[model samples]
Every structure is written in C-alpha cells, then in structure tokens.
Target chain A: MKDFPYTESKDTRSGFGAGLHELGKTNPNVVALCADLIGSLKMDAFVKDFPERFFQVGIAEANMMGLAAGLTIGGKIPFTGTFANFSTGRVYDQIRQSIAYSGKNVKICASHAGLTLGEDGATHQILEDIGLMKMLPHMCVINPCDYNQTKAATLAIADYEGPVYLRFGRPVVPNFTPADQQFEIGKGVLLNEGADVSIFATGHLVWKAILAGKLLADKGINAEIINIHTIKPLDARMILESARKTRCVVTAEEHQMNGGLGDSIAQLLAREEPLPLEMVAVNDSFGESGTPDQLMEKYGLNETAIVAAVEKVMARKTK
Target chain B: MAQSTASETHAPEATKSVAELQQIATQVRRDIVRMVHAVNSGHPGGSLGCTELLVSLYFKVMQHTPEPFDMNGIGQDLFFLSNGHISPVFYSVLARSGYFPVSELATFRKLNSRLQGHPATHEHLPGIRIASGSLGQGLSVATGAAQAKKLNGDQSTVFVLMGDGELEEGQIWEAALYAPHHKVDNLMAFVDRNGQQIDGPTDKIGGLGDLRAKFEAFGWRVLETDGNQFETLLATIKEGQGLLGQGVPVMVLMDTQMGFGVDFMMGSHKWHGVAPNDEQLATALKQLEVEKASDY
Candidate 1:
C-alpha cells in the first residue's frame, strides 16, 4: 500500500478556506463573496477575520458574480464561491459580461465538481465545468489536486491579475504535495518519470495516477506520472516533452472525456506531437447517488482503470 | 451597514444646450438606423427611442474624463447599457463624447471591430465599464459598482438602463433586494419601458404588471419621465441625481415609444430588431431633420 500521509483527511474546501483566510491576513485587497455556500466553501475563517471584506450574496449566484466583478473596479480582489453548476452555467452570462469581457480581477472558486459530489447526482455534479470556463477568453482555469495544492492555488489566484476559475472537488484526496509549495498558474509537475508510458492527470485523479505509477513499476512497466492541474493554458510543453520520451500517453481525470483533461491532451498531441493515447474518465454518462468510491468504479475513473489504460496505450506505441 | 456620507461633486463647467445635444442624439439615431440596415441584423427600435436619453446622460448629465480612460471610473458618473443590442446609439454617443474616434462608428458590427453586435468592454471600448447584453445583469453590475464607489469614498453615481422585458430576469430582483437592503443609494437604474420586446408587446409576452409599484416594493424611490422629451428627461434625471444616497436607490421609469423619432418605424414592436432599408432609411432621416451639428 502506498503511504498517503497527513493525519486527518480534510476536504479541498477547507484548503480553500485556509488559503482565503491566510490571504485576508497577507493581502488587504482580498475579499470573499459567497452565494449561501460559506459553510460549504469553508469561508468562515475569512468571514470571521475580515467581516467587512466578506460579502454574503445570499443564494444569488448571478448577483454574487456581478458583485465580485464590480468589487474589482475598486482594486479589491474578489473571490466568489458556489457549487460547480451555479458557478458556471447558471451565472455564465454574469461571469461572461462583468468579469471575463470586462477584464476584471475576480476569482471564481467552484466546489463540488465531478462525481465526487455524490448523492446529489447529476444535478450538482458538473463534469463539463472545465470546458465551459476554459472557453472564455482571458479566463484562467485551475483544477487543483489535493488539500495542500488547493490551498496554494487559492492563495495564488488571489494575487494573479485578471479573471480566473479555480475548480476544486467535494471529497478529500491524498495531501502529498508539499504544503508550502508555491502554486504556479500554467506549470505542470512531473511526479515520477518513466519511459514505457506517460500518465497525464489532474484533480483527484492525480493521486490515482501516482498510485498507478507505483503499481505499473511493480508490474515492470515504467510510467511517467505528470500532474496537469491547470487545464487551460495547458502545460503543452511538459506534456509533449514527457510524451516524446515515453511515445505513449494515458490521461486521467474525474470528469467527462469530452471536454476534460484527456481532450486537452488529445488536441495538443494531434497538432504538435502525435502519440497513441488512452483516457480514464467518465464515458458519456451522468453520476448517480453513491459513495465517491462507488462512483469512481462505476465511472471508470480509478487507479485500476489508469493502469489498464497505460498498458493499452503502451501496446500501440510504435517507438 | 455603513451609510455613504459623500456628497455629489459635479465638475465646474458649462451646461450644454438642448439643441446642441439633440443634434448629437439625431446623428446617433442615424447611426443606429444605418448600422442596423448595413448588417440587416441589429436592434433599431429601442436604440432610436433611447437616443435622447443616452445623449442627455452622456453629454449633459454625467461628469467624466474622455482621455486616459480609467477602469475604476473614480470621480465620474458611470453609465451601463443593460439591453446592449442598442450599441449603435451607445457607440455613437460614446464617439461624440470623445470616448473614441467617430470613424470607428463605420465598423460597428464588421470584422475586427470594437463595436460588437452587443456592447462589450472586452474590445477595450473606453466608455464601457462592463459588458452587458444578456439582459437583467447590468443593474446588478451597476449596483455593485455603486457600492464600490461608496467603499472607495468616491461620490460618483452609477447609472444603468434596462429594457422592460429584461425585468423578467430574476437576478434584477435579486440585485434589487440587495441594493436597498445594503443602502446602496449611490446607484440609479432606468427602465426603458418602450412597451415592446422582440417577441411582441411586453404585456403580451410576460406582462410586467406594475413597474413603478414593483420598484417601490423593492424599496426603490420610483420616478417617471418621458424619455423622448429632452428637457423633461433631463429634469427627471436631475431629480434622480438629487435623490441619491438618501437610504434607497432611485429607479427612473422612462416611458418611451419603440423607434421614437423614425417615421415608418415609430410606435410599434415590428422595428425591434429589423433593419430599415434604403427608402425607409431616407424617410426616417428626413423625419429626424438634421440639427446644426449634423456631423454625420
């Protein structure tokens, strides 16, 4: 069994809360606005510490987004929080106009992404959020992997000028990334390098890819595991460099295959470096009421799936 | 909730003549008709009707610096067009006010043009503070900007114009509840109750039962005005300005006709988005009557 440390497993939302609270202390310009998701988004620390700066938009996602955009005009860095669906599709026009099109410095923090938002089912689980957000011009899309990374990303996005969408999940994954590691916007991290197959992953699936890399090593199959957290402005150079060495690639993400990390990798490979690729993702299906583990198995987004995909893609490798 | 204590500080300057401003309004209306006609794809009726209102606000009322545009819009009365399809009127007014060169009006909806089909700040249009086209969102943005101005100790007012049909969007009401509850009295919202929408009459489509009563219910001080009449519109806007920062935001319900000045297009919903052709444009131009500052 791989050692996934950090005593009590904390949800990614706590990371966002901790980061935002820290941001409130470090940066006076940081302000948080929530649409009735303060408790869910773990923004209580920021709210308590800086009451005046935190705005409770009261179950109005559209108003919250607009308020965030408006707050930016006064040089205040506004961080808006809500569920993934409401953060994207419900308030797309508000975000498109007030923030993205207007070129405002607004941090759109969305939680409860993907099948991990179990029991709430397809209604809340937004697998297409990455696609919806990445399409907007001047919008930076960041899906941080673990607790530490999420916190770092939250803090980092607060300082980065212009509009950004920081997507995190509902469940707690391995907190392996260094807690003090500075988060870079468009850079991808290579976890373990190998030559047999390159494993590209994002969000919760990054831990799964790490485990798959270990498993593949045990099976005498070298796996180069790369963490691609930033989906848009994708780490194309990192992905291509790793893929060229391995000549085969497999992408993993807790999202739909259509517009997720796999599709991003495919587009990069098809244009720059052609390579045989396999994807371990939800295959054109909506999630249902179940535990996170059950959903991962049913949706084919697991370590076993990643291992299988690596083997399959490796077989098709020519060089 | 801290109440805003700052007073309105208008620039010490000369007031413009109604006739002088009306000339600009007429040319803007001409731009609205021509741009809509050139593409065969734009909203003209609401644009024509709101020309004088926009002219009164940008030219005569609002105090803003035309050069070295600032995004925050400190020390300036900011205007947001909620129903953004009427960009020709807005673009023309912005041009005449010197937000950009008047030459850009010719590139309204053409390729690589800053003047998109809908008004967007993304193209870096100087006068536009926010991108508005998706209805009912401009008021919320304006309310937020108004609140920001208050926070920054700036006494500038934030003005927004919305279509009567756009009132159907729930976000408008959400912002309505927030503005007065938070005491965001630095904001003024105007509803262009032109009585028409793309589908048909607003009452027939969705029925905005009682606009004044609705705004009043939302804790806004409601005022009514004839949007077509320059003096009356200016007087009403001045009244709205006088009532600002007095606990509740003021909403001016500007009653207007769809395609107000254009002869063939006036008084009906049919001119909502359809373009007027060559002969129709000629008749409309004749009815508009070129003012002394007929730069078009």
Candidate 2:
C-alpha cells in the first residue's frame, strides 16, 4: 500500500469554486451561472471577482441550461452550478435538447451529489446523475475524488469543447491529491500497486478505498487502488491492465450499484476480460436523513465495506 | 468564417412590395407542401399559417447573410424557430433566402440529410443557430443569444417564433419571466397564435387565456398582427424593431389560421402534423399557385 497522508479536510465544492475563480482570471471566455445556490455551491469568490461574467439565474435550472447553451453561440464557455438532483433530473430534457444534442460547450457543475449530502434525504441526494448524464451522446460525465482533483477537473473541463457533467459532494473529505496536479479526462489515477486485487473507486468513496488498501495490506493481502474519476469515456485500458495482473476487481462509489461505476466496470470486464468482481455501493433503495458517516455505513459505502468486498472478490478469484 | 458584423448594414428597406412578397410566399407555400409530401411526413398547417411571417422576416425585415453561413452571427440579426414542427416553412425560407442550394429541399427528413425533422445545428445547417424541436426551449435560447449580443456590443435583434400551445410548457413561462427581468431588450419574440396543437384545438385541450395580457404582466411590450397578412406582419415587425433597446423585450402575438393558404385545410387542428396525401397535395398546390413558380 502507498503512504498517502492528508493534512486537512475540505469539501469538493470549494475546490470547484477555487478552480472557477482561477479560470475567471486566466480564461476570458469562461462564464459562470448559478441557480440560487451561490453560497452552497461555494461560488462567492468567482462571483465577487467577475460579477459581470457570473449570472445569478435565480432558482430556474432549465432557463440556466438554455442560457448556457445560448452563451455558447457567441463563443462563451458557460458553467452552470446547482445541486446534483436539480442539475440532472429537474432539467434533463433541457440539457438533452439544448446542450447535449445541440453539442453546446456548457459545463454543468453539480454539487452535493450522492448520500454525502447528509440530512437532505433521497430527494436531493441523486445517485443516478452519472447514468443520466453519461447516457447523453455528447455529454462527458466526471466525478472527482478529492478537493485538489476536483479543482483540477474543474479547470480542465473548461478547455474541453463539449457538454460535461462535473459531479462533486458537499461533505468535507480528505484533501489528498496534489495541489498542482494536471487533470486528464478519461484517465485513471493509480494510487497504489498490488498483485492480489484491483480496487476501482470514484467520488467520495475513493478515500475509503485507500483506507481499505491499507487494511488489506495489514492482513497479508495486496490491493491495487485506482481512482476512476471520469465515469464516461472510462479508462478501459488501465482497468484491463490492472485486472489482468490482479485477476479480480472491486468497484466502489457513493451511488446506486445498478448504474454506477460498478456497472460501468462490470460491462467493460464482461466484454474484454471476465473476472471475479465485487461492488461496494448502495443497493436499489432510497436514502434517508442521517449523518454522513451513518448514511455511508448503512449504505455499505465505507472503507469497511470495501475491505469486505475485496476479501469476497479475492476468495472467488481462480488460482 | 468572417464575422457578419452589425456595421455591414442591411439593404435599403421596402425593396420588395407587398405583392412581390406575396408571390414569394406563394412559392414558399408550394415548396412546404412538396417537401412534406416527398417525405410522407411533417407538419404543414402551422407552416402554411406562418408562411407570411417567415417570408416577411427573411426577405424584408431581418438583416442576415445566408451566403457565408456563420454559426456565430456576431454582428447580424439572428432568428430561431421555436415552433420547430413547422420546419417546412423555416427550411423553405432559409433555402430561398440563399442559405443553401434549393435542390437540398428534396432531402427533407431523408436519410443523412441536413434538414432533419427538426431544425438542428449539429448538421452544420446554414441559417440555424440552435435545435428546437422540443417545445418551450427556443425562447430561452433566443434570450440567451440576445444577452450574448448585448455582451458583444452588437446592435442587432434576436427573433424567435413559438407556438401558442407550447406556452403550456413551464419553461416558456420561466424564460418569459427571465427575459424582461434581465432586460433582454435585443430580443423580439413572436407567438404563432393559431390556437391549435397536435392533439386538438388549444382551447379544447387547454386554453391559454389572454396571451397579450400575460406577456404585458410579465413586463413585455406586446404587439398584435395578422400573421397570414404579408403587409400587416411586415409593418408589425418594423414597428416591433422600433420598440427594441428601451429596457424591455417585445412580444408579437400573431393571430393566424392553422391552415391559411389552402382553402380546404383551414381552421382545423387535424392537419397540424399530418401530411397531405398525393391528391390532397395537388389540391393544396393548386391553391398556392404562383406565376413563374420555381419548385426545388
């Protein structure tokens, strides 16, 4: 296992805010629009610095999406901010027609994704956003793990010419990645190398996978951990290469097991290299109001769950 | 592509008289019926109804270039077809206005054609800035483009034509409120008040009571015009253009029959999306006959 230490915890949304502020200074064409969640989305710095560029589209996600598409007509790269549910579900048709099908360069930045949006319940905590966005032909779906990685992804997507759904969480987790890391879309980050099992994780569950790697190492089991941030245009080459060495895989995410990262990996492995795989994710069920820790525990999305999943997948591995 | 800036002013106004525009509209109506009939599918009622409105904009009112089709029409007046089901009319106007070869009209709704069932930008189709088959989205897109024009310091107008029945979509109301609030003064919107939808008459299905009153309440300068009358619509567009940039978007509630040009297909919602049969097409074309008519 690799020695990955973190000195502080920070919400991924703040990382997005920081990246957006940087883009405001660096890229003249980059513009921001928020749907009545400026403070929640942590877009205060960007809004203050570039008030003219920032559009406060009050509480209308659909209009925000349409305006974002229109802004692209005049060579403006628009980034819309809102919660995950409102971003994907509430304005799905608008995104499909105006942005995705139209092939507009609109960055749909969604915060408070998955069960990490504690106490808001299932209504606000959207587990199907990755699926919803990835299904669109032109949309690139990205879910970064830590604060630094989220910031890097935010800045990188601005240069990408197409619709993108950037998903992050509200909870403050480990800020582990490098501050100046280059974010490459559709590329997986290898955190640790092992021979027994390959652990692929995304979003908030990536830290838990790291902790699980440590636990597995202590128990005489070697685990390879890879951060699968960009869900769509998934890094199949890395996955196949790691799976060939480990012979088994365990996927983890703070989303439903049905259409989340696990499903994506399962489909890839089924086609190219079949292996014994276990998924640590929420089953087909709605979440309830609870603390982040409690909800993660109840939903089987913690380090302990990952460790158990690794053990199970390893046990099923053929010699 | 070179930007078609606002400084390249339009040709002198009133170059074509009402009679000349009416002749072009007759040919456009002929093209709409033929294109829809060739595909054996498309909406013709609203197309015929809005023929004069589109004719007036493309040939007389709007200052746009069709020869060098630029997606970012930075300095030119832009138009979006919100009621995209009436694409036959929009495609005809665009083709006749020299956006593309008129021969391409035969490819409407065919395999691998730029003229999709709805107006789409993905095909790189000239004169189309956005895809808007899905209703209630164009107004917002036009408002966004209008804001972009304002940001670019372009002194040109952004026009969008929508369906009255499409007003039931909540997003239309959302954009309606947003345009005036943001002071999107560069936008001039027109609603095809034909009082019909796909299912039935709009009133029988769901009434949109007092559209002018609704727009006025939402802080818009409302204007009314007879959409099927070429002279009335041309004058109304000129008047609407005069009302722009005073800190309010203009809305033109154009009253039109569902099927205006053809005598037999008029005033009913049955032909909203249904294409005319071969014999019916002959009858409709006969009614829209024009001297020296050129069919693509």
lDDT of 2 at A165: 96
Q: Which portions of model 2 miss their true places by more than 4 Å?
A: B1-14
Worst 10 residues of 2 chain A by lDDT: A130-139
Give the alpha carbon lDDT tens digit for every residue of B22-53 in model 2: 99999999998899989889999999999999
Against the reference, the lDDT scores of all candidates come to 0.85, 0.90
Summarize candidate 1's per-residue lDDT along A1-319 as a digit string, tens digits. Answer: 2445665566887898999999999998888889998889999989999998878889899998888887777678889999988999898888887888889999999999999988888889888888889889879999989889999999889878899999997897778888888999999988887888889999999988888888888999988888998998899889999998989999999888898889989999999998899999888887888998999988889899998998899889885
Q: Can you list each candidate's DockQ?
A: 0.68, 0.76
- Point to the candidate with the largest lDDT: 2
Chain A vs. true chain A, TM-score per model, equals: 0.97, 0.99
Please report, as a residue range, the 10-residue window in candidate 1 chain B with the lowest summed lDDT: B1-10
- After superposition, candidate 1 runs with Cα above 4 Å error: A1-8, B1-14, B38-40
